[model samples]
Target: MYFTDRGIEELTARRGDESVTLEWVSDQLRTFVDLHPEFETPVERLASWLARLDDDELDDE
Candidate 1:
C-alpha cells in the first residue's frame, strides 16, 4: 500500500460511521491549510479533486 493509504485507513477506521457534508469537509481542509501552511498545495489539490470528483475532464489529465 502507498504511504498515504495509512492515513486514509486511519481516517476510515476513526470516522467510518460519521456522516459529513462537503461544506464541513471544505471547512476542515481550510482549517488544516491554515494550521499547516506547508501542506497548502496538496490540500488545495485534494480540495479541487474532491470538488471535481465527478468531472470527466479530470480523467483526461
Candidate 2:
C-alpha cells in the first residue's frame, strides 16, 4: 500500500516506542479496506492475508 507523508507520520505516531502488533496493524488495514473497497483483487487478498500474518512476518516483509 502507498502511504502519504501525513499517513506515515500518523502511523509512526501510533506505533510509538513499542513494536506494532499484528492485530493492531490488521485493524488499520481492515479499516482502509472498508473505506476503499474498489481496489483490485490482489490488493484486497494481500490485505486480508496481512491481517492474518504474525507481527514478525509483517515486519520481515
Task: Tell me how many clashing residue pairs each candidate has.
Answer: 0, 0
Task: State the weakest 10-residue window (summed lDDT) of model 2.
Answer: 39-48
Q: What is the TM-score of each candidate against the true structure?
A: 0.89, 0.41
All candidates' lDDT scores?
0.92, 0.72
Tell me which residue pairs clash in candidate 1: none
Model 1: CA > 4 A from native: none
lDDT of 1 at 18: 100
lDDT of 1 at 25: 91
The alpha-carbon lDDT assigned to residue 1 of candidate 2 equals 58
- What TM value does model 1 have? 0.89
- Candidate 1 per-residue lDDT, tens place, 1-61, comes to 9999999999999999999998899889989989999999999888888889899998999
Please give the range of 10 consecutive residues that has the lowest summed lDDT in model 1. 44-53
